[model samples]
Target: MGKVGPPITGLPVMPSDLPLDEVPEDVLREVLEEEKRIYRNRSYKKKPYPTSRDVMEAVREALRVSTRIHPDEFPDVVLHILESKGFEVRHVTVKRIWRAYETLVRKGVIRDELGVMM
Candidate 1:
């Protein structure tokens, strides 16, 4: 065998550098909270999606055209409609559409007569 290097040892390790199992729970929680705070402070480059009102309006229009479909199809149909209108449909957007649908139903903006909000 060729010459081997000496086994590694003797490095200064901070408390944060300790193995996860060795770190105290309180310290880990503090570190996690700090990381979250730092992340929230960072600026993001992507453009934000359309306002909730706009999304809700799109969902309403889509529902109008899909009146006979089952209620469970609402999110997927709305996503397709939004994408067809040149909006980027993300999972978040789909979730927002479902939430807006519920809000509209609670506010009486969409009615069961129209087969839209039920």
Candidate 2:
């Protein structure tokens, strides 16, 4: 809350001020200790985020089923499938999956645009 370094013209004071050599040892030490405290509170790799590969897997899974599905129903099915499988399904994720689905359809990865197996 207090001013950290020399108050120049209109610049806000921070621990790592312009003159690296001029900033006092105590201020640098404070910043280091703060950083350490923040690091200590983190959950390191405990709950990792889903990667693009995971989303691709979900997209493939959603479209690979034998049943016929309409393009309009893709988002709901994708959400259900991915969420049930423990992927963090967001709006953007569903959009990505839909685009991937369309891409696969265009490239003949999926047999039909309407999602029919035949």
Candidate 3:
């Protein structure tokens, strides 16, 4: 009968050498071309922004309230209050509110909060 060996033991061995510092030229070129193709496809596409009716209604409410109150006087506070009142006023939902806030800031409705437009 052939000699039998004992079961393997201890931790597995690892490679002693490090990988290449940079990708090979051909591979890099292929990656770059793929990225360019993806960019071109995305650029040609007309991506739509958020435009929910509930969000629009929230924006209208903000606009109506903003007209009477100074936007800068307390933009965050006012928004918080409206949110507390259950306006569903999320940054995502109130994109129009952000736009109106920016307009209000430009029109002196509120001081520029960190100069953020939205």
CA lDDT of each prediction against the hidden true structure: 0.71, 0.66, 0.53
Model 2, TM vs. native:
0.45
Highest lDDT: give the candidate number: 1
Candidate 3, 2-70: lDDT as tens digits? 333443675453322324444489987898999999998877543233344443344455555655554
Model 2 agreement with the true structure over 1-118: per-residue lDDT tens digits? 3435557687786645555666689988999999999989884653335665666666678667726777678777776776777656554455676666666667766656464333
TM-score of each: 0.50, 0.45, 0.27
> What's the distance in Å from true for residue 67, model 2?
1.5
TM-score of candidate 1 versus the correct structure, residues matched by position: 0.50
Query: RMSD in angstroms, all models?
Result: 10.9, 9.0, 12.7
Error of 2 at 93 (Å): 4.5
Please say which candidate is ahead in lDDT: 1 or 2. 1
For residue 5, give model 3's deviation from the true position in Å.
61
Worst 10 residues of 1 by lDDT: 1-10
What does candidate 1's lDDT look like per residue over 5-59, in tens digits?
Answer: 4445755545454455755889889999999999998966754466787688887
Ranking by lDDT: 1, 2, 3
lDDT score at residue 113, model 2, on the 0-100 scale = 48
